[model samples]
Target chain A: MSSTEAQVKEKKRGRAFSHFKSLVMMQLKDKLDLSFLTSTKQLIAKVVFFVLRIAAIIVAAYYIFYYSAFFSIFAIIAWVPPIVMALAFSIIFILSVLSCMVGLMKTLFFADDNRVLVTMPVTGNMVFFSKLVVYYLFELMRSYTFTFPLFIAYGMVSHLSVGMYFWMAFVLIFVSALPVAIGALLAIPAMFVYQFLKKYEPVKVTLFVLVVGAVIALIVELIMLIPENINFINDWPLKYRPSVISFIESAKTYILPLYAITEMLIGTYENLTFTLKPSNALVFLYVLVTIAVVLGIVYLIAKPLFLKMTAQPFEFEKKEFIKAKENRKRRKYKSILRKEFLLNLRSSISYSFLAVYIAVPILILLLNKIYAAMSTNILGNYMIYAFNLLIILLILLSSNGIVSTMYSMEGRAGYMKKTKPLDMTFPLLCKIFYNSLFSLISIIVSIGIFGAFNSSSIGVGGLIMLALTVLFFHIGHMVWSAERDIMNPQNEQYATTGGEINNPNSNFMTVMAFLVSFAVAFFSFILFNESGVNPITACLKLMIIAMAFAAMRIYLFIIKVRLYYREKM
Target chain B: MRKSVVLTICVIYILSIVLVGYLGIKLAIFDPILYVQSIELIDDPYSDSYKISHPPRYPDQDFVVKEYSKGLKFRLYCKVMPENATNKEVEFIVNMPDNAVGKLQITSDGEVSVLSDDFDILYAKVYILSKDGQKARSRDFTVQINNFKNPT
Candidate 1:
């Protein structure tokens, strides 16, 4: 080619690279920056949350090492390292897919900056490519956290060489690329499905519930299929134990990328030499080729669809209906609650979250089936020990998040709550009541299912006590979040600026929920096992503790509501 | 400044509550009484088999049985946590065939003397009771003694 032509081509390439870099940096800044804080409270909240997140990571790493030690003993006996790696790879794959699916949806359709970006001079492919890069990095972080500790444990136990460590690190850097690419392939279709469901109100919840239930069940099955648990299948009455052997075989046959990754890791680590085994080299080639092809395909397919889907606003069409005379006489609180209910139902995102909320029971039922299949009477009791906490975490996520966002979702319309003659707490209470009702019913159903199908020794009294405990905690969580929202209405303040949905306090709620659930479950299980107390008596004591906590939270909620009225808007 | 004071107080209160709850959990779950730390079979000189401290409440795996010549004595050596060793009560329960293959005796310590040379093989359980009585004879460990004329 001519020199001028080559120069021009290089210039074009440079320009494109700069565009992509700028876009990615902007997206990352928008998502990661905590500089919007003006108050001491917000800054402190940010610092506290950061510390908590780091603490969670450390705890997770510690457990990974601890568990890996036990598994490594099996490895020494039966060459279990490869099998463990395979299972870990599968988990990482699923986690990457789920997280990337959610993250892509937020970045593509739900992000506030998308409208302005689409109208810019840059091509749609460039924007999509840059966003994909950000998502790839995020998935890489997740994958590293999961795989690194296990890798270290395996290395320590197996006496792996320095060469193996360097090779493993090299492989780890590129491992997440394939899963992120696979996730991108699913993101567009998922968006279409959700959009279609958004149009159909009546069937949406049912379909969404089935989808979430299936996803959760699949994850649970994957977890159980690990090689360490494969022995349980030996005594299983069923012909198939859903063995890890079969899972690995299927992964090699179907999900070739995961198989390739696992093969490479095992092959490279099994020897002290720097040289890769022939099998590892072949699979490594497969990994590289598959990632390239998948990325190419995803980029081509998503390029046009990304712009079209993102440019079109996510609209949940408001239905206008004449008010019926018969419904006009409903009590004010009931009317307000009914209105809040319909409002949430009208938002597709909100409704989708509701489906996940409802799916908690279905997941519990699935877990119960698995537990019943594999567990002895003793292990069955252990499942019951953590059962109440699992339900409460589900409630916290499903109910509290939606309830807390009730007022903030009003946007410019929040002035009505301030201006309306109705008692401020009246609307807040209605929302909380509506949220608590949904969760309370869910808790009751879950308790019944656990008692009947789980083969748990928690008994009827334990079940009732659990139900009451979870119900009170759910109410407390909802009230606490509602009071926070009323005191600090956020989304409406930033409505004109067109940023993302601003629910800063929700993260705190989630962190609190996790801590509380972990503490409750861990301690109660230990107490029931170690202390000579009867299981029912122990459960009752735990219930009383939970009730006291809820009572304290409610007192604060009432005080906050009273104070909210005293202050002027 | 007033708002910051209230916020700080709230943060402190929440932290204190969490700390107290953690301690309460520790109090309830913490095991006061010490238990068996390890067990081994000393019958076979060629092979050494040992199981490190079984779970406090659950004995999931069968104890490894070591076989020896018919004339050899079957001995089990168990090590318990040395804490409060004086007050601890250890019991040894043996179940043999109706033909009564072996004579068994357990010392105040956790050592088991099985005279399996009288007949064939034998099985026994080691139960340890805590001094506090908070822990009863909950988890009983198992042992099997096999009399093989040939040790491979």
Candidate 2:
């Protein structure tokens, strides 16, 4: 407790605070990603996307209110607000826990900047605590951005008091801390499992594929669980109906920070008094204490473990050295193709999409079961076929984003290709070749499964037509996307930012994916259901359209890529 | 390996074309409503009477038996079939014989009604016809109305 010792301690504390501030600012800038706002075109696109996202949340709320009323899931229509709120809160909390868990694990343990941060003049614990603080702010920002729309929707629907609205905002700010704490605990076991998986590539990739597939399937199943045309809606077969209310009420208490929030908000807003209920105040205290205990344990364990893990050199270097000793060589095209395929196999953008593509056929079969269970007899064979096509195309085209970013992801290698005497078009074509192959196989399998199961209703002819149409469209879309990137490569941006830059090409492709799928499905379904037009004919028309687009993309890329490459060089 | 993939894809493409063309021969226009497969006259399980879902196509066929002693109005549902058939809409008609004893009427949906609770046994021929002119008549059309009370 000498004066000099106290002064040194205070100076270190100040230094840690400064480090925490700087780290948080950097993280926020990266996360906010308002680079797109500087350009008018990107700003407009982003605004539209933001508006659409908010509208989607509101629309989802609208459906739950009406759909519940329609099904008489609630005894009275007046109960719609509570049901929507409870469901929204529980779902939001669950989703945040998952997102925060993965994000925290990566940010806390695996951020590339960690090595540099550790070597700084600050103490190890300062770096550890600073990272935790920075990440807490990150989780807070993310939760707010995502949940803000939900708050608006909930408030508008419930007509809440200003006090209650402010309560919601306050809860959002600290709510993410609980997940980060829980995720920190969960990350312990998860990291060990991850380390184990990394040792075995095939096992890891298989598990990765299944996990992605299962997540998508789970979402689809949740959507399908809603009663489509339940006749007994107004007079639902219920002994279980009253219990839905009880279930939701019970769920509200179990929904974590939301429950605490509800307790605090209800206590404050009563009779316009600022006083808190003793029991409600206890719940808030419980949340705060739980967060503190978790952080203490993480500090006791994760902080030291993280420092040790960072200090060790990366484990992959030795294996890479052994591979280099093997001295494998191949032709230019073969080597380039192998490199592309290897990147995919190692779970790049292509790999993730590949997993989804492979899972899609199975998903189609599962969705078809639900469709059959719900009695698709109301729709025609052609209509059923059209729907199946829509599901397949939506998944396939959305993955075209992988193709759009392929050139830019090459980093320095992309520019180096221009310096060499490589055939620019050939290499670009090779990039999409594997994807096209993988996509075609998946699309065919999807068509086959849909056709086989519904053969009694939908003819095999529709299946073939759908297969051709989507395949052509998939290839054409890939080419078009790749062409866009080739003409205006973002390799420098990706290199500088470590591939965390705002990629307009990828975003545009995703938006276009949704619009194109809907248009194709809607138009073709209309045609097929029209009298005197066979499914084959309707699909034949779609096939021609897909082929024409593909042909145009192929021709343009062939002629334009070289010219663009020369102009850029 | 790349050549092999290209080869396999080409082969599959050719096969798909041939297969589609072959299977597509059965691809006709909208599956037409062929016939009234079953014109079932069954009581509703959920209720004693069934509410008709569509407007009466044969409005003239819907008649009340005037000059009767009691209310005997009852609706009978006609279940049309060939589930994939387009426009399964049906109309009902009563082909009354001159020798029939009791006054009877049928609605477009095959509802059988007579105002009298006490009438001599009536044998009325009821037919269900689709838009394509295909007909199906219920063989169990005789009503023993001698001591019958109005159920509806």
Candidate 3:
């Protein structure tokens, strides 16, 4: 009733709106920064990249929609078209939630900018609200980046009505919100869990292993869904087909969100005419209602939590102060190696990448089992063996890429290496040894698993020969990789920015990972199949070459790298 | 031009194009896809919808043991829509069970061969593809194993 009270309220609203606009613009500047696109060549490159990406999306969508491959594959699983739509939507929803959770947590609480933004002359709620809007805009943009091209491509491939395009846009906008809301609700808990993990190292490692294991289990389950008997193809288990179809059909009507969207978009338009079904209106209403309720809940719980977290994120972090160990007499190199390991352990990037590396053996084993289960007509025994080695070597080599950035990651601390009267070779060995040791573990585990279960033909003696060959070759590769880093170190970029800015080392390593994996496979295929040599004999020959290569690389690396080390110092 | 120093590539043609002044590149964007106006996989090509054989034994359930000798072969046929769609080619392959000692062969052109007399009924699938050359097409089909001499 009071005009002055109302004016104050209006002023606050105006200020909040201004802050929201500025915050969103700030994020857009961060993400879609085009300052790098200064060149005519760069413009051409961007245009070409855009064109190619569009072409890829069109090609993929066309294949999945207009082409028979998509249909027949679905038929193989006894799934109809509607079910495919349902599954696709569900997968997108899940991914959106996951990304939203991670992004929200990082931006809201963990980001360095959180301190600056929260301290600004605005309500914490205003800051939180703007972040969510910008986040939602980004999430929507991301969804469209993945999907909108396909929409256009599908329409171009097939004549879709303007109504259909409009309907898709409508559904995409609302459906996207549901996931963001879900992600926000999950974010605080996830951050708490993250803090818990940061406090406990073993727990973090174990959780990551468990996550990878869960992925393996899911893959196994999906693979197993392919029935063993061809007779079971039509009515798998012969009896359940009707009941399964009926259940899906019924679920399409009643299943809350997935079915509502599915029924509205896919199954409704039989004649390809976008006639507004009464049910479509109802589904639209349901979608709006669902988003409203979920977002309302997110506001109720997450908003307060965000404000609290903005004020004091430390509340969640249960810091365990480990007592410093008494300085004991240890070898200098040992201390160097231990320090290197500890540095990598603390880094979130290094920690996660290491976790992936650790799980490589299981992934290789499980993947190889899938390959084994397939009864290919043309591929022979040697092809399988070669592929198995390729997987092992490929993963090890790619992960070992971090070794190239090892010295560069030292940043300002690297100055100590230059100044201290220490043997440069000692530090170089420290960097090379730890990751090589990691690769060695992964390689042996993979080979051991392969030797144990993959094939009986490769006896223990044969396996030892193969293992020795790979081990020697890997040592050569790691040293060569380290030498490459010393030759072109980006010490300042990494030290100052602390981000994974593009580097030649990673780019070259990725190319080599594929190249080396394939070359070894190609050569083995030739040696074993073309020459008609037994697998054991092939291993023996490879071992000798690998040993020789390792010798030359190590000898050359030691002599050459010391000079570069001195120059840098 | 302030940032011209940052551009690594100093190509004459590109620079000339930039001078010729910001004319939009006219690409067809036919970038129109590989799409069909309407594509539906007719699972059972014959009879209104899918119907099992008389007495209705599913491969997952019971099988009708219509006796037939080894080396029996039959051609499985299925049609895709437009009735005149050019590349309606499909591949039929039988999935072998874990305990399957007997093997069946299905050809690229949808010919099913019963190689062993050890097994009863085998389930098969068809992969229909577009070998339109520019792009490829395929249709996959699983069929009822019809033996030439099976006495019903």
Task: Pick out the ten consecutive residues of candidate 3 chain B with the lowest summed lDDT.
Answer: B1-10
Candidate 2 TM-score to native? 0.63
lDDT (tens digit, per residue) of candidate 3 on B27-104: 323333333222323333211223323333333432212234554554334443332334444444356666754566
Worst 10 residues of 2 chain B by lDDT: B60-69
lDDT of each: 0.61, 0.65, 0.62
Encode model 3's per-residue lDDT on A1-569: one tens digit a residue. Answer: 69999999999889878877887777667768676577888889888988787778778877676643233433322123455456656677678889999998888767767667877776777677777777788878766776666655555444566777777777778766777777887887998999899878899889888997797788656645644322222333235544554565565554457755755653253322224578977887887887788778877887777767666756576666789989887777777888888876676656645664566666556545544444432234566567666666666666556667777877777768776457787777777676667667777877887776545676788788778777877787777777777778888988989877677876676567567666876786666665454577888777787798789878877888788776665
**Between prediction 1 and prediction 3, which has the larger TM-score?**
3
Candidate 3's error at A445, in angstroms? 2.8
lDDT (10s digit) by residue, model 2, range A1-569: 99999999999888878877776666667567679968999999998987787689667766665566554465322224343454666677677677767776776677777788777766778777776666677778666666665665555544555676666677566667887888787777777887788788789879977887787778667746645433232224244555665676667656656655654543432211223567766777777888999989988888877887778787554653333356577888888788778766665575566666766776676656545443333234455566667667777777787678888988877877776458689878987888888787888888887776676544677668768899988898889889988877899887887845667887787677767777887887677777343456776788899899889989999889878877777
Two-chain DockQ for each candidate model? 0.02, 0.01, 0.02
Which lDDT tens digits does candidate 1 get at residues B1-152?
12332344345334433333333222224344354343222232111434433444555743635454433333344333442233334444555456665665555443455554654556666554443444434345566556654232
Residue A275 lDDT, candidate 1, scale 0-100:
36
Flag the better candidate by DockQ, 2 or 3.
Answer: 3
List candidate 1 stretches off by more than 4 Å.
A1-13, A34-79, A97-115, A118-125, A140-149, A172-175, A186-195, A198-203, A212-257, A268-275, A298-334, A347-412, A418-425, A446-569, B1-152
Chain B alone: TM-score in each candidate?
Answer: 0.43, 0.48, 0.43
